[model samples]
Target: MNDKKKKSDTNSSAENVEQHLQELEKADYERLYYSQEQTFSADELARSINEQRLTELMAKSDEFLKSLNSELEDFDD
Candidate 1:
């Protein structure tokens, strides 16, 4: 009888744990799917703008390099 009671208690505890886990999973799913989502917070927007400016600078640098390469090729007679 004592062994049976111990087994029942273990099973009850396991079921309770499983129920709590399920609740947590459901909450997570709801948050993932239904949460109000904004892609760009203010800090994120500032970083994006900075990156865009850096990319424009890099493109200008590439164009300058190409022009310099063409000038060098012209002198390779």
Candidate 2:
């Protein structure tokens, strides 16, 4: 009977440890997920800003090209 009691106690202790480890793993996973999500959001914002800047640059380039073409025509005549 004493041996049986000892076995039961050991099993219970093992189960408790396993449960605690699972909980810790879950918490770690949640933290990592949120961290990655925030990083992705920041990357998206940066990409958007860069796209806007490129668009503005393209517009300015078009205007400059048009002016240069006009000057070239005037010089030819």
Candidate 3:
């Protein structure tokens, strides 16, 4: 019974994390889509470029974190 409960709890937590990540991904995609759609003057274009850089930086950050986590898992045995 305890093992079953533990498994259930783990699954529930995993589902929650997956949902949150999906929400964040959707929001990021929405922002990127709008950024691509909107018109920008020269100054606005510079601002847009900065915003895109920030977005790319965030994606890189997530990738780095995921890679680090996977590497740490490999050392866990």
Candidate topping TM-score? 3
| Model 1 global lDDT (CA atoms, 0 to 1) | 0.87
Model 1 segments more than 4 A misplaced: 1-11, 39-44, 47-77
lDDT of 3: 0.89
Clashing pairs in 1: none
Ranking by TM-score: 3, 2, 1
For residues 1-77, what per-residue lDDT tens digits would candidate 2 score against the true structure?
Answer: 99988877778777978989999999999999988876456778787677877899999999999999999999999
lDDT of 1 at 77: 61
Which lDDT tens digits does candidate 1 get at residues 1-77?
99988877778777989989999999998898875574768887686677877899999999999999999999996
Model 1's TM-score against the true structure: 0.37
My TM-score estimates for the predictions, one after another, are 0.37, 0.38, 0.41
Worst 10 residues of 1 by lDDT: 32-41
Give a tens-digit lDDT track for model 3, residues 1-77: 99988877778777988989999999999999998997778997676577877899999999999999999999996
Off by over 4 Å in 2: 1-49
- Output candidate 1 Cα RMSD: 9.0
> What CA root-mean-square deviation does each model show from the true structure?
9.0, 13.6, 18.1
